[model samples]
Target: MIVIDPASAVPPFEQLRRQLIDDVSTGTLAPGTRLPTVRRLAEDLGLAPGTVARAYRELESAGIIETRGRNGTFVAPQGDAALREAQRAAASFVDQVRTLRIDPEQALALVHAALRSAPTAP
Candidate 1:
């Protein structure tokens, strides 16, 4: 999920691109996760498809994400061991969610609840 601020001086494409990169770093968007199509995201954000496409293109060029023909874009894998483990866990969780046919919003809510209650390491 991304938000576009029309009032900001930063271009729409840059905003989209940067937010996605940040999401990847924060594990909000894990590697191998499929992204919404440019056209679909553009429609949702009220921006031109070109704007979204440009952002995707830039991300692809920077190795932050990749696009496969007719398959859609995905966050590219990272070199960090912790991130890889996180990606694996996320993929497993997603598979379990799909297998159980859980509502995505409900699943996300559960994850938020778990994160909130989880104890942090000292």
Candidate 2:
């Protein structure tokens, strides 16, 4: 369902990246969803393969998707209980911030301050 507007101010790769991220985050693309291969997606979108590859690389770097050699790319599974809990907490925080109409910069500032005040482990 991803659309790339040829006349958009945003770069095509970035458009793809944001859409895929949004899909994964919102569960539109559930975990284990197999993404189209870079070449296939590029062909479908009428973009260069490198463009799709770059988007895939960025998503993989962000832990949103994983590439398994020969098996293709798929949405990354929630790996551990603690990590899943943390993700849920983060989603809750985002919802709360949205409800409060907090700007991203202000919300990030709050997070930074909280992080600075938190005690570190040995």
Candidate 3:
């Protein structure tokens, strides 16, 4: 269920990367689930093989997935660690917002602003 938004400001590879992370984090792609080969997924998504490869490479680096040589790629058994951290942070934010009597929409807007202003890792 990967989707590429043509109108998005994010690069296609990044979009794919994030979607895969979300899938893995949410159990949409369960631990040990085999992933489609880079070539097959690129063909399915109408993307260059290199794009898919890059996404897979980053995923592997982040310990989200692993490549088993000829056996292909599979989700990591521990799921996404970064996603777990994000969930914890989100829960804390929700609690803080509730305590402060902020509207949910306002809290979401604040989060969006923070994300937009976030600096990239060096």
Top candidate, metric lDDT: 3
lDDT tens readout by residue for model 1, 1-122: 78888988788998898788778878899889899999999999999999999999988866778898899899888654234545767888999999999999999999999999986521
Q: Give the best candidate by TM-score.
A: 3
Q: Candidate 2 at residue 8, lDDT?
A: 80
lDDT of 2 by residue, 20-98 (tens): 8777767888889999999999999999999999999987866778899999999988643234545766888999999
Give the per-residue lDDT digits (tens) of candidate 3, residues 3-108.
8877777888999988888888778899899999999999999999999999999888778898999999998888464676477679989999999999999999
Q: Estimate each model's TM-score.
A: 0.64, 0.65, 0.69
Candidate 1 minimal-lDDT segment of 10 residues? 78-87
The local distance difference test score of each candidate is: 0.84, 0.84, 0.87
Report how far off residue 61 is in candidate 2 (Å).
0.5
The CA lDDT at 76 in model 2 is 88
On a 0 to 1 TM-score scale, where does candidate 2 land against the true structure? 0.65
